[model samples]
Target: MSRRPHQIAILGTGYVGLGTAALLAHLGHHVTGIDVDVCKIEQLQRAEIPIYEPGLEKLLLSNTSQLTWTTDFSAVQQADTIFICVGTPPSADGTPDLQFLQTAVASLAPYLGRKQQIIVNKSTVPIGTGDLVVRLLEDLAPEFDASVHYVVSNPEFLREGSALEDSLYPDRIVLGGLDTALDHMISVYAPLIEQSFTPPASAPRPERYTRPAVVRTTLQSAEMIKYAANAFLALKVSFANEIAGLCEHVGADIEEVTTGIGLDSRIGHRFLQAGLGWGGSCFGKDTQGLISAGREHAYAMPILQAAIDVNARQRQMVINKLLRHLRTMKGKRIGVLGMAFKPNTDDLRDAPAYTLIQRLAELGAVVTAHDPVAMARAEREWSHLKYSSAVNAAQVFQRADAVIIATEWDEYRQLDWEALVATMRRPLIIDSRNLLRHPLTAQVEQVGRELKGTIGAAL
Candidate 1:
């Protein structure tokens, strides 16, 4: 059943928020994007994407008239559905800080009228956070009492580069809140619910994936679902890396091993890419958040905990591999290719490159890093680190000991192999991602030096 267009406000114009906002507008809803950064808002107002997301800028432009950008929280007062897409980053103690969510709710407290509005939690938050946000808002706003303020946990599973596409045609749409408002949500997303909505022109047309049924459950279950999904993915990735390590010891090809196991249909083969362990905004934080939550319930999640531990050790494995090849990291000028977690964006919040960079630099190595997009953020994060354009970055490897492939980007794979060997003092390379192939490997070995990779051994 097609319904009247709704007013939707997305808080935080970061990758998740902007992508959500643009996709909603494309779905024929009136979207007002609010952000604290005036510069970002201004850029969005002109149909410019503040961050790098594939095909996002064009979508923003197409939906410009329907999408309004602002830095005001008062816009929430008029919103029929308010999606809290702010960041809930984990602190050092492995707990998610609710500062951003608290601030967003408090700022919009005064303007929330008696009229009922659906408050949606669209960020990746700790389990039971939906209830906490509701309690906080109710406690903060006394005067503006509403009979119905349904707090729904609608956690986003958006990958950075493909966020917009994921938003429009999601694998699932889990809504957790009062069953009373289930009708409203179904009505609100009826277009997608019916599969009658058109995707943003800029994005790739989604293959007709089975339309996900809206699972209505208690808010707690929905919150748990998000953490579970991410934790399981992290676990799978770590498991694959562990297998990759074993493959190295036993002279087995991880790629073939994964392929054979993946074809079983029981494993399904996603997130099984044996490379540097998983790192990004989601896996590390979500795992830690789950572990913290487990402690509150007097349960020990050893399996999950070990998964996190193994991921951390994977970084050390890379470092150890580099150490084995060169024997010493000191005085070596290392070129780190790809700094962002998964590439196509500049988000370095929990990027594995952070750990790799600091550890290498601490070992008395001068690091020269290059990312197709994230070098600027890397520079800001690591002030002492140096940046290089793609063309000249290989120069850092000149007279340098080892080059570590940290992030796998398309451009990084197509480097001039001969030139790289020619420029480097020692043409040694550590392929952390196993991104290089036979031709490149043979070339590197031709120069009386061998390139070592993680899939197994000193090939």
Candidate 2:
């Protein structure tokens, strides 16, 4: 295995791409991030990350000398390992769209130097995408030494908020490609292999037990593993929501029920916190892609499809809860506590809060929403609704007839519930995440207020 430092280029400097570039550079590799957005490149060049990731900026600033962000494709010519981290948006029929992946392959063709470079698909793509990308590269650069270009399916498993941690200490790193390239790719991750350095910056470092082994599987299996992991997590949330609904009817507290079930080692609670639903970039898209992949292979992935269907209903369930309270949303003023899907990041791509806010507006409710980072994105997506910071937006709740705890941000959890409720016209609080059910929920109920849980009716 060669120990030579590789020149790596990460295409698409979004969350996955930027995190990958930062972590790789921190491991002492030469990394250049490329994207068509020059303004983003300019921001990154100045050591400013365009997005809000917890520890990403620190790593980006620390590795600026080795990490470069640019709009030029010339960088592609010098890269020993180029990761295609561009988006593979879902098609109208819910299948994975390969247009961006294909476009990236075409763009890299003209710059195929004689050097053998591993062109890795770091993007979350469908199974057999490795073969498709490899074929596309060959057709596009037939005149060049096509044999030098190798395609690998190295899917990213980073979450939006904690991408850095997940990258550094990934539960497992699944590298998929031709058998010939496996050893070389393993050598590239030697720092992690030898335990010389830590995992990516996104995952939480273990406090006691030994680290989980990084599994190397076949490309198709590796691709399937990514989808399967996300699908299961989504399923867990949907399952929790389904149980929460059952708990409401049976007079069982979901918090206590989830805690009891979570105590079991196998079902060790992580995504079991029942909320409006799972809403992020991965779960929805990957589950659909997996179902599409199953159809392509003439297999039925009914279980995964049910998880997707359950998640969709979970979001609507929150709207229904809100409707049950006000009876008619017409002329109602609704205040949303959190707007981003999950707190800490400003990514509002598929946040459930948006769905609830939209539904409220459609039903003639005047909605005012607040989120720490996602306000700009939400403003763009839902132009009609009012966006305010948690501080100033206190007025929205002050005059609001009802308040919906949509995102369950830590900031929202720490809010002075008594004071905040004092501002509201009706002082009604809906704990969509059961976030306040503990000491806070008990405290609020003692204050003679009408509070509702995701599944339970208002008190």
lDDT of 2 by residue, 48-110 (tens): 788888888877887778887888887988888888989888899999888988888888777
lDDT of 1 by residue, 429-458 (tens): 777787776444222211111244443222
Q: What is the total number of backbone clashes in candidate 2? A: 13
Each candidate structure's TM-score, on Cα atoms with residue i matched to residue i, is 0.93, 0.91
In model 1, pairs of residues that clash are 399-425
Full-model lDDT for every candidate: 0.78, 0.76
| Global lDDT of model 2 | 0.76
Which regions of candidate 2 fall more than 4 Å away from where they truly are?
142-146, 198-205, 209-212, 384-393, 438-459
Tell me how many clashing residue pairs each candidate has: 1, 13
Worst 10 residues of 2 by lDDT: 440-449
